[model samples]
Target chain A: MLQTKKWRQYATFYAFVSPWLIIFIFLGLFPLLYGLYLSFTNFTGFNMNQLKFVGFSNYKTVFLDSESMYALGRTLLVTAINVPISLAIGLFLAVLLNLKIKGLSWWRTAFYIPSVVPVVSTVLMWKFIFSGDGLLNTLFDKLQLQPINWLGYEYATTALIVMLLWGAGGSLLINLAGLKGIPADLYEAAEIDGASPVRKFFTVTLPLMTHILFFNLIMGIIGSLQIYIQPILLSGKTLLDSPIKPNYLYLVHAFQQIFAFQRFGYGLALMWVLFIAILLLTVLVFYSSRFWVYYETDQEV
Target chain B: MMVNAGINKPLLRVVVYGLLTVLTIIFVYPLFITMANSLNPLYSLSTLLPTAFEWENYKMAVTTIEFPEYLKNSLIICAISVPLTTLSSALAGFAFARLRAPGKKLLFVIITSTMMLPGIVTQIPTYILFHKMNFIDTFYPWLLWGIGGAPFFIFMYRQFFSTVPKELEEAARIDGCSTFRMYATIFMPLATPATWTTVIMLFQGTWGDFITPFMFLRDEHYPLATALATIGYHLPDNPNVILAQPSSAAAILFMIPTIAAFFFGQRYLVDGIAAGAVKG
Candidate 1:
């Protein structure tokens, strides 16, 4: 009788969740599996009918291709550079805002406003800021310094980094929440024990906030790796204008090869490789996080 | 923790106020410059402040970009997608929190695990899938993705739902309310804050999103972001295009809705994100 009741309850539960399951299976998992199969075949353009069973050749081409290799390198480099810098800045800002300062809410809101702005607007804003005769250049001219090429190959990455910092508001907002969650009693106890703010921060705040930090780090890395619109818009591509030919950025190269050149097999192969690389990195991070990511539950540890 | 300090703490006050002033300037100055430069008659690259406020740039921006059409499209997409996403996620969230089911834990794990997969991996395949389904140029694919509950949204709703008192739901059930009715009448009303948070998030996300519309929609169907991009980059020579004014104006206009939403929903956002993080 108990088993029958449990079964009925389970049926109701499953019925409620069936919509999401059906969508995930059909739209998410099916496409993923089919795409995996297609990656091993020679499928190009919009023609699924023309697929040939090529078996590992497409993967080989991706591995051997210089352009793909360059893209892979650039993507990793950007992630490596941007993630740590953003995290540090975000943490610093959060800590500053967390202090019992006047107009705290207003300050927090101000810092977060930039992140909520539309991407196209932000990109356009940055483009104007970085233009040869735009704001930055004008400032340089007033200072009697030579104007730098902000969008040229040597400086484009730097420009991207600057633009990215404006969006650090999201990370900062989350970190502020993490800061607020740390108990006041713990800090008071530490102070009574003659611990300096710096010592208490390292020993208590940093260790306890690791979980939130880890979440932010993983999300930031993943988001940065897939960056497209900013660079695409910055390069000034339009419907009427010829598609901005990608320069050295690996993402642009991969995007062009897939969309512009109609090499779906190669694109799929490239995407899969990226997927595996990210998956491995994430696994490695989680594995190492056992030492540092302090879960509230001892069972998790 | 209150400090018993003298009233004449002049040095400390000066330092604190100075630091705050500098940071505030850094944050607010860009908006001021953008708004100011947009009204300048010449639209020249030289001036930091407009010699005279033209007021014509706003008019040009509205007329030239067909701002009304773009705004209409954005409203329609947000209106359709936000409610659908909120409803679906809320239902699934309630199930996870309240229902006892076989494979519940397994399903939760599966859904959460999907969060680990980077969006880039799915982009090409999903694009191909949508293309094949004849959804490339239409708004259907964009709407579908938005309405489809992502792991983050599900996790949030579940966390929020778990906090509600079970007695309320039980009483409703005892009053001959079906599970659906109980959910609709009792649970949903109690979860108004969570619903509002979800709506604000979905609205901002759909409003600001540039990539999906850029990739999927053609020129005639281009939304505000795409239109802004075109004005900023493509129509540099066409002075008549409203978006062709100094980039600052375009940026300011684009920021207005998002900034407004953030301020309006500020309290809920901080609470929701913080609580959600702990539960997650």
Candidate 2:
């Protein structure tokens, strides 16, 4: 009797969540599996009849392709540099904002306003700033420094990174919340022990804020890895820019090959590789976090 | 001792004030430049301050972009989608948090797992599906996806509902309240902060969304972001075209609604985000 009741209870629970499950199965899972299958076949534009199951060949092409290899390397390099620098600046700003100062709320709002601006506008604003005779160059000239080509091949990536960091206030705001959650008593005790503010921060603040740091670190990595809009918009691509900067072109090329060229199989393969890379990186971070991540609850590892 | 303490306090206050002012400028100057340039009269772009205010640029960009039509489309889409997204997520969240049903944990896990998938991966297939249904050009797909509710919203509401006390619901149940009333009267009112957070987030997200409308909507139905993107990208050739003149003006107009919303609801947004960061 108890078993039957329990089963009915489960059924009732599943019924409530049925809507999401149904959508996920059809929209999310089906497409994923279909994409994976399409990656192995030579499926082109709107026709699956021509899809030949030439297994491993598409994977081989992507792996050995010089252009794709360069894109992969570039993506990794950009992510590595962008993540740390943005986090450092964001943490610094969070610390600044957390201090008890007058008009603090206004300051917080000012810093966060840019983040809520539509991406199209933000990109356009950056475009204006980076133009040959734009604000950046004008400023450099006034400072008596030689003006660098802000959007040239050598500096375009750097410019994008800088644009990205301007909106770092969103993450910084979250960091402030984490900072506030740290018990005030801990800081008071540290001060009583004659610890310097810097020492207290390193010991009390940083240690307690690890969970939030972990959250930000994961979110930042995931968000940056799928970077598409800013580069595409700023670089003047209408659809997918063809012959993407040899370094930045691979993901776009893969996307185009799937959608434009009808090489669904190849696109799927590329996607799978990306998925695995992200999953592995996340898992690695979580596994290594055993040493540093401080959970409030005594949950099992 | 008293003299030294007073001296140190003032010095610290001055340093804090100085640092904050510099930081504010760093954050606000780009926006100021964008706004100022939009109102500049000269067709030739200047890097420094504008000599005169040109109000015509704003009017011209609005007319050329067919701003009224774009604004209507944005409002209609957001109005329909935000409520549907919030209500459905709240329902699902309530069920997950309060129901005594089985498989809740598994269902929750399944919903969250989808967050790992990048949106672009799902774009092509969804397009194909919508095309088959003959809903490509229409707003049906956008509405349907929004109504389906997002995992992030669901997760947020679940955490929020969990924080609500069980005693209220128990007392209501003893008073012979129906299950629906129990949720509507007790649970929903208590979860106002979370609901508002979800609504604001969905509103902001839907308003700024470009990729979906760009992929699905026809040219006649372009949303604000898509319309602006079209102008920004296509205006290089004819600078004198009414739409092309003072391109920065159009960008400024695109951002106005969002900036306004952020300032007005900033306190709630901050509180919600803070709670979310801790619980999430």
Candidate 3:
């Protein structure tokens, strides 16, 4: 009777969990492996049965292809710049909002409202701002300053970065949540020790919040690398003719290759390269966390 | 919050208010411009207000982008996907947290690790898989995976379910409640916050989603986000365009539901995010 009860429990467990299991296996794991397989074979997405196993040729092409190489470099540069600046701005806003102020929720809502607005909308608004005859240039004209072409090759990446900064409030909200998690006692202790507000922030708050910072850092790197829609929406004519714009990042390149050029095998291979880069970067971050990230549990220990 | 006690109180108040006001303007200005321009096709950068209130932009957006069809597809996807995803995610969470299923840890690790994987790595193969199964072009690719595919949601749910005291489940089990019964009758009600969190999160994600629909769906089946993006892409090529009136209007229409969702669900959204941040 006991053995049968255990068996029944096991069966129920499987029944309860099999939905996620089935989906993960079929939709997640199977496809990932198939993608790896397709990366090896020269499949142009025309016919599955016509796949030709080209061994390491696709990987070679992804590395050697000029557009792919430039895209990788450009994406890395954007990620390197965008992640830190955005996170800094987010942290700054979060610190400000953590104060004892009225309408705090309203302020947060106002800030985060842009984040929830559709990306297409945000991109559209920015497109108007950056257009030659748009808001910024119009302002410059009134100031009697030379009108710089914001969407030109010189400023395209900068335009993308500026546009991305508008949604920094999303990360600010996350950082606010992180700030809230820090125990009040830490700040009190620092205060009793006669620490200044700046000192207390550095010693008590920043240290305690490093884990959250780490989380955001990892997420930021991953997210910034996969930027697709903004570039696609903003590029307009630049990307259609030449896929090598400063704003034409990695995922956009992969997308144009796969969907636009019908280079399925090549696109998948490029993504695999992207995957490896992200994994390495994430691992580096994780490995480096031992020095900076702190836990209250560590203090207790 | 209490750290500024030593400073000049009145000065501090002024600084805080000043900072908030400036930030609020910075945040809301572009949106205000967009909303104003959406209503005024004769938009110019010189004035923040429109010369005339014109309904033509809205009409133009509707006709040019097939706004109604896109909205219908988005609603259909959200309506079907959100509830199914939430329910399955909760079930998975309950099983992982409350039950003694073997290999649960390993399975969960596999799921969570997918978060680190570049999404595009899986995109092509998943597309091909759906293609092979003839699930492409239909809503099946979205509905199926949406219901059971969110490892992050499952993780969130598991974290929540773990917090429910074991005594409640033990008591429920003593009354001969089946696992499903205990989950349904006892634990699910307690998981309301988690459910709401998942609902809002998944709703926003599905609604704002562009890549999936852009890649998979035909023009007839495109969501509002994709349709608007596609139109926005081609707008500059139109020589007849003077002020991006139709695009601005399309943007406003696309943003309405999300803004409404934010206003209605801000509390749950913030609470959910706080819970994730605290626990994770």
Candidate 4:
């Protein structure tokens, strides 16, 4: 009877999670493996029956293609600029608010609200502001400043950076949580020692908050690398049309290769290689994290 | 929260408040411009505030597209996807936390590892899969994805469930409560915070999802979010001459639901981010 009951319980566990199993196996895992297969075949999306295996050529093309190389370089540059600069602003705001500021919730709400606005809406708002005779130019005109086309090639990346900083509130919340997590006694001791606020920040706050900053850094890099819709919307272009060359990030380039050009095999290969790039960078970050990312652990003793 | 560590309080207070006010304007100004310009097209877009209250811009925006149908489609997408994804995620999460089955540990690790995988890798194959299944241009993909259970939410629910005191679960098990019943009656009631966090996130995610529908659907089937791309294309000949009037009105309308979600779930949302970050 006990054996039967155990079997029934096990069956029930499987039964309860059956939906996830079905979907994950077929949709998640299968598609991932199938993508790898498709990358090796010269599949132009429409030619399923006439699929010819072309080994390693698609991968070679992804690496050798000049536009693809440029896109990768651009994406890395943007990610590099975005992560530290945005996080610094976020940390600064968090520190400002952590000083027992009046109306803490109100301050938080004001800051955190923008980050939650749908990316589509945010993009549209910025696009309109960047339009030829948009509000921004009008403001510039009022001040008698030169009203250049804010949406032009030179300023396109600048526009992206502005949008990045606008949502810096996201990192603020995380940093604030980290700030609050620091023990009060440390600050108390710092105060008793007559340490200045700046000294206390470096000695007490920064050391404890390294892990949170590290985590934010990882997430920000990963998220920024996937940026596609923003540039597309900002340029007022569709997925089919290429954004201005400066705005062409790797994902957008890969997307155009697949959908616009119907280079399915090439696109799949492009993504797989990009995946490897991401994995390698992530591994490097993990490897280097030991030098910078501090963690409280058993090894501390 | 630390209040004092030999900082000059009054000087810091003045400086902080001054900077906070400036930051507030910088953050909220563009949104304000959009809302203000949305009011009336005839007025200049120069002002910091709304010049006129013209509700006609919105009505015109609606008439420009198949607005009602797309609105219904968005709602239906949200209705189907959010609850289904939330529940399935919770179920899987509760099981992962509370139940014992062979290979469960391995499966959990695999699912969580996908978080680090660049999402673009599977984009093509998943599109091909959906196309083959004739799931293209339909709500079928959301149904399947909802059941697939987003790994992030699963982790969130699992974390929430794991924190529940063991005695409560054991007492219920001793009372002969089935695993499913224990999840629904005991754990779920306790998991309301996680549920709301997951639900709001799911809702916002579904409501604002453009890429999925952009990939899969025809123009007739686009949701409110994707459909907005069609509006204010009044001058196709001069693409640069974007009339920011009715589009801004529409943009504000599109923004309302998500801004509402933010207001409603701010606490849970913050907690969720903090939880996810701490795990990382």
- TM-score per model over all chains: 0.91, 0.93, 0.95, 0.94
Candidate 1 C-alpha lDDT tens digits along A1-301: 9897678778878777776777777667777777788788878866777779898998898889987787667767777888888888788778777656778888877777778877777777777677777778887999999999888777887787778877776787679878877877777777788786677778778887898889888888778777766777675545223223332455665666776787877777877777777677778888988988987786766
Interface quality of candidate 4 as DockQ: 0.60
- Candidate 1: interface RMSD equals 3.0
Give the alpha carbon lDDT tens digit for every residue of B97-195 in model 2: 877775677778877766777777777667777788898888987677765778888887788788878888789979988666777888888877777
Off by over 4 Å in 4: A1-13, A299-301, B1-8, B42-45, B230-232, B236-241
What does the lDDT read for residue B69 in candidate 3? 86
Return the clash pairs for model 4, or none.
none
TM-score of chain B of each: 0.86, 0.91, 0.92, 0.91
DockQ of 2: 0.46
User: Poorest 10 consecutive residues of model 3 chain B by lDDT?
Assistant: B41-50
Q: What are the C-alpha RMSDs, in order, of all predicted structures?
A: 3.2, 3.2, 2.3, 2.2
lDDT of 4: 0.81
Docking class of 2: acceptable
Cα error, residue A153 of model 4, in Å, equals: 1.7
iRMSD for each candidate structure, in the order shown: 3.0, 4.0, 2.3, 2.4
Give lDDT for model 3: 0.80
Residue A224 CA displacement from its true place in model 3, Å: 0.5
lDDT of 4 by residue, B183-278 (tens): 889999987777888988888888888777877888888898888753444555766555567777778888889889978987877776666556
Q: Model 2: clashing residue pairs?
A: A38-A265, A39-A265
Could you tell me the fnat of model 3?
A: 0.60
In the order shown, the candidates' DockQ scores are 0.49, 0.46, 0.60, 0.60
Instruction: Identify the superior model by TM-score, candidate 1 or candidate 4.
Output: 4
